[model samples]
Target: MTINKYPIIIISLILLSLNLQAAENYKKFDLPLDLINYMEISLEGKTAVMTVFAGDSSQSFRMESLEDNRSYHEISYQGSVVLNNEGFMSSGAGYPFDLIDKTDVVFDNKKTRILFYQKDPESDVKFRSRKKNNISIFNDINIAGGDFIRGSVVSFWADIVINGEVNEDVIAVYGDISVGQQAVIRGDVISIDGKVDIAKGATVYGRVQASGGKKKFQFDRWTRWHNKEKDFSTIIRFYYDRVDGATPLLGVQFTDEDSLLPNVEIYSGYAFSSEEWRYYVGLEQSFWLKHPITLGGSFYRKLATQDDWLMQRNDNTVFALLATEDYRDYYEAEGGYIFGRFTPLSYFNVEIGTLVEKYTWLDAHTDLWSMFGGSKAFGSNFGSVPAAERASGIEALDGAEMASIILKSDLDNSDREARFGQSFWMGTAELEWLPDGWNDDFDFTRYFVRAGRFQSLNEYSGFYIKAGYGGSDGLLPLHRRYFLGGLETLLGYRHKEYSGQEFWLGNVEYRLTFPKTDITGLLLYNAGQISEEAGKLGDAEVKQSIGIGVSFEESLRLDLSRRLDRSDSSFQIYVRLGINF
Candidate 1:
């Protein structure tokens, strides 16, 4: 045993070497918290520099050496100096610094503050400009308490906290904006890539905005002066979606200073299969700084296929049709609609509006089919049809005016953990009244309500449930009725397979996410019933489907679904470029 002691020592040394090699890949940093509040710290080799902003002047201090997170100020230059009672060191070699005058930066006249300083021969601390030592886009200045900024306060790459009044706009780019309750901003409050929180009683004379793209690095250097800065911004997004029938779409939005209100969007696309034009222009004015009224309007000139609903289909299901490549039938509606919203609280809102439209029905006439190679999917114009369907085509609508009213309650927290760990509740009811006149004989009333919720189960699992019911009264035309099937309702059934003046649908899904990855699996079930009358809704034949699928990074969606009631039913193929479940 004694003879083996030497061999054991050598083996222990080798094990320690391996452990060191594995742990040196990451760099460690430690600095005192008190030093960070006033000055920005940066690392230069093994040294750190603290740059502080005073009333109208700026100064830099070199931290040559550090022991733990404590700062020991030691001047490392010829003219280097240290404030004894203040514990401050100026080591920018050869740079003239007045110790007494710079002491105003921190206000404290006593006590050494900087952690440590040594002669950093690796670089001369004296002649080194703070540019490389730190980066700031503002002419640094700190206002005393109760300070009032009379003009627009603009700073880039800087965080601002407002305790006093800012008579004009306060714009902080690439930084966060904190508005204390006692603080008043007579103008807009905007933060490009950071959060903006206004205290409960804080009064913002203008709009407040706090939003950015997923990539926080997205920056715009369009304006140099805060006052000249435009209160509006434009964003363009390009993506391929299922609703577009695998077509890539170019969408653009114009948002005002406050992200919550007054916006415009315009979208248009050419269908690959439908071979037609689809376009939409929408405008909204909602959630004003001091008011809850919301005004909106839109004008659309596109091929709108009847999906067992609407004189045209412009509801949420419009998205479902866009993923389609070919549509068996469609109608044209070119007109405008105007609506106003009144929200009393975060939980509920009411909207009332009017729509005036002229409709044109595209039917499969005998000549139309024969002339087009006898393909029902081919339009008379040889254009690709939308990959959508309906049970039976309706007689051409008489083209009338209608009034619509809606009440909604939406409570969503899907952002809690970014995915399967959140809760949501949403309920909405819409009523459309087709009044007599407008040179049309169609007069009807249509109404519906939908609600859904998601319950987060731990970090890897989630449960979702949704239900809906729709009904129509009076001379409700076929196109204004409801339909069930497709992704929004019955996934395993064909689009618009069931149509009626009234309908009910429900969906449930269980989601499980793989640990430490974006991979997710889903178990989905869908069922729905449709009827001509509300009384018959309960007895309507039920169409059901069950499905299983997996998604990766939400970029690709693949699913296998089968009809539950059909003996000959086989798994259906549903592939979406964009994830929906």
Candidate 2:
């Protein structure tokens, strides 16, 4: 659905054109402040109404929150109005007003379109920053007449002024790009939310494009505030599963650019079915000596799962709600850990951590129901048990405490610029050790490695291959074992039909992307083996499947797969969100 922004834009232009008004000119409405982060005040003659938004959108704020006292204000209607950020709401025009710092807001009563202030081409901040770096954030860039920049000049939340020559693209985000007389640009000149002013004598060898206006610029500020990339932001999330039922979670994350500390995250949630609370708090600090290194620690009590390789939480929730089928088991993990990470290269990182955790087995609730399949109850949470053990009875795992040293490494070169069929590859390795001398009931060492590569045949097609291996050197805990034959791993078989202590799997796919569209087609093949023996993957009977599917923008997908190893095998239908590997 397309939203019409013309009315909002017209309202904003009028308010910005008027000069600052005196405080006594217009009548004030003493509306009570609510708990939302945004407040709006709409005026119609002598009557003024107040309302607040959940974050920055149009959603009505109904519940009280203790998240923060800061909020953005929106004021509307024609009048000489002065507002102090004392908890009043606005109705029409959306101008960004910081309630904490800005003591007064003035709006115009006349209707007129106004443009943002233009940056001076000869400013020193721009000229000095040009030679130091080609890119600036929250700061303007100026290229003097005599200066020649050999590469692209980019500014984020800032403006760009050019009187000299630029060899590549000049881009400004939420800011303007001004090409002075006699200036030359070899590449595209683009402004995302601001204007582009090119003098008659200015030479742009490439395309010139400008989109959005000043009113929308204020909207972008609200967008950035609530965006995950923001330095400080809070998020509200809802989750569902057979074990937890319905869970509502709230999270806050903060980071300072100029400070030594780089990141902090806190989350708290409640599970309605289990009637339990979950929480997490973590912090990370970065040190720059010769290379960048980070040290961090966290404490958390969470509904944990190890089958992320099979399906993500949100995708599994859909299956659980619609069909009473959950592809993953759940457990309660309460733990605290400290870790250090080092990134010697942009696409690679290695982390070493020590984890101490107490684990409790979770039971699937039979009383809770799904939208469909109301007659079927949830399966036992116990994982990978043999046939004889399942025939006797399924029992919850004994609670245990264990300590382990963890080592992990990741390498990837995926192209973030492309939506699909990018020629990239990634690999990861992890190892965990629980020594017996630590007085823990579990004594084992586990290791897993996975790697994948994608080769773009062209803009229209691609080929992908992936393989993984997992095995244990000691007595592996029930929750720490391996399983195969599922939607993502083995499409033709039942969920987790193959369970064992060791496993190896391989998958290959050929993808075709239609031109000028988001639709894509795929041909897939899968092979895997699993066994009770620690290193019997090679000797175990191999299972195989072949399938075909289509996807829309790499999101929703449907596939029909059939087993190649069995004569009586039939086609199985599967739905998925994305390619897991």
Candidate 3:
């Protein structure tokens, strides 16, 4: 070692010089804390351009040359610029391009402050303009594909279409924003007095606000938004049933094209089996008082049922046509009803209505045919149990002129972010009254209360529970009574196997959805009791059933169920559509 001290000293100096030279090839910059998730930076040779977004506010800075060692200055470009690292070389580059590369670079945004590092040269940066890069007023702004904006974009009295990338906030006042599938935004998206429409696969790193698009209270699942952009549309409906056979209806609807006008519908159809003409005319008007209130009225002459809670009409139609299974009893109801619905909160609704109708008993047709169960006859419209064995309250339903008042309320607060399903609690309470001396064949006061809850166990599974009780105070008409059995009720028994003036039912279900698929597996338990006499609900024998099912797209379903309390009972299979609750 003592022989070559001069050479060792010379080598050490050279290595030190190389290390210092490498250090000069990198650059570091501080970013706003709030914009850690809402900022983008691109380098073009010696110039560095950056945009930072904070809620509705955004700022942009441009550095001319890294060799100049100057601070970033504000720029006038409000739109995005395309970023490219092509044509970048380590051999013949000037400032920033000579300093940075694709590798050995890290973007650290998780900290309170963001740090951007650029170090080698396989990645040169380029900014290309497809259009003018600035805010707009009275004219729509469009960002074409492959374009990138380094600053916030603002538009007034117009719309914005983004098919590219935005480095900061995007704001639309009195306008709308439409983000394409491939668009990427590194900042907040804000639409005032309009809607933010995001296509699938679009990415946004900050909050999205649609101030003008509010969720409306849906009266029922059939409620649909009429195309406001169109004048009107025609609707056609068709279904099969034991009483009506094949029923087809045509209708036209007018929506809220003008704020002062109400939504109106008129439809008429013919029932081939019943040989009767059916029609429904309805009008609904909404007003925003202390809360949103809807006033509506309908005049209808058609087949009706009290068992709509068991299955939806669309799902029941499928079962009736394919399986020769009609879970609901039918009656001819010609009536007019006026109702008022109030939404005191986003998740709470109260409705009050009065109806006058002439009721006539319906007889099931023997010629009704099914696809699977060929030539099978439908069951009696009255039910499985004999009228004589039922309570005295089971009065005849034919030729009864009745007037009734109903009050109903429901509360639903559900979590929409669950992966498998929703987690929430929902409850409904209803009371119907037909006071004595109303000059009608029916005189009864009835009440029903039901509650249900869903619990999301994890991303794949959920638990559901529901319970209901219904009872009458006076002579409930035969058609007004409760029936508990197969399908949505106690799956262990036949349809309408049990009937009563008072009844109680409960169900528990666990469901698991397959990852990345619309398929779901279900395990469920159902139990219920029905009493012939009012106030004697628990006196009847309790029937219990356990079932397993699989569903596709949460619609089409196949189920296998068996009685839990009876060993003599065999398994029952069910094919249906839609959710029961």
lDDT of each: 0.52, 0.65, 0.66
Question: Worst 10-residue stretch by lDDT in candidate 1?
Answer: 98-107
Best by lDDT: 3
In angstroms, give how far residue 562 of model 2 lies from its true place: 0.9
Off by over 4 Å in 1: 1-228, 231-254, 259-283, 305-324, 327-329, 344-348, 363-394, 398-413, 416-419, 436-439, 577-581
Better of 2 and 3 by TM-score: 3
Clashes per candidate, residues 3 or more apart or on different chains: 26, 7, 11
Among all candidates shown, the one with the greatest TM-score: 3
Error of 3 at 488 (Å): 1.4
What tens-digit string does per-residue lDDT give for candidate 3 at 1-581? 01233553465456445434533443322231211233444444345655444445655556574224322221223232222122111122212221211111122331111122231111111111112124555568999999877556666467999999987677775588998878877666766557888776576654566553351121111121221133366979998888888999999987652224688899999999888889999999866422446789999998988888888788888888888888777889999999877665557787778888987766778578889968787876765768674323234566778887777889776523222343567889998776445655776788899998877665577788899999888756777878888877887678788877899999998988888888989998998888988977767788889999898986688989998877888999877776656
Better-scoring candidate (TM-score), 1 or 3? 3
Tens-digit per-residue lDDT, 1-581, candidate 1 = 01223453465456445434433432211221211223333433335565544434657756564323232433332345532223344443222221111111111222222222221222222212211111123333233348776445544456777777776566654567787766666666666556776565455655565544542232121221132222344433332222223233456776554434468988876755335566779998754332255678999866555432221232222333343233234456777888766544334555566676676554432222122233333223112222232322233353533343323333332323243434556566776654434335465677778877766565577778888887776645545666666556777877556666788888898888798888889899988888866567788778889999887876666778888989998888666554232
Error of 2 at 103 (Å): 42
TM-score of each: 0.51, 0.61, 0.64
Model 3 misplaced regions, further than 4 Å: 1-159, 162-231, 257-259, 387-395, 414-420
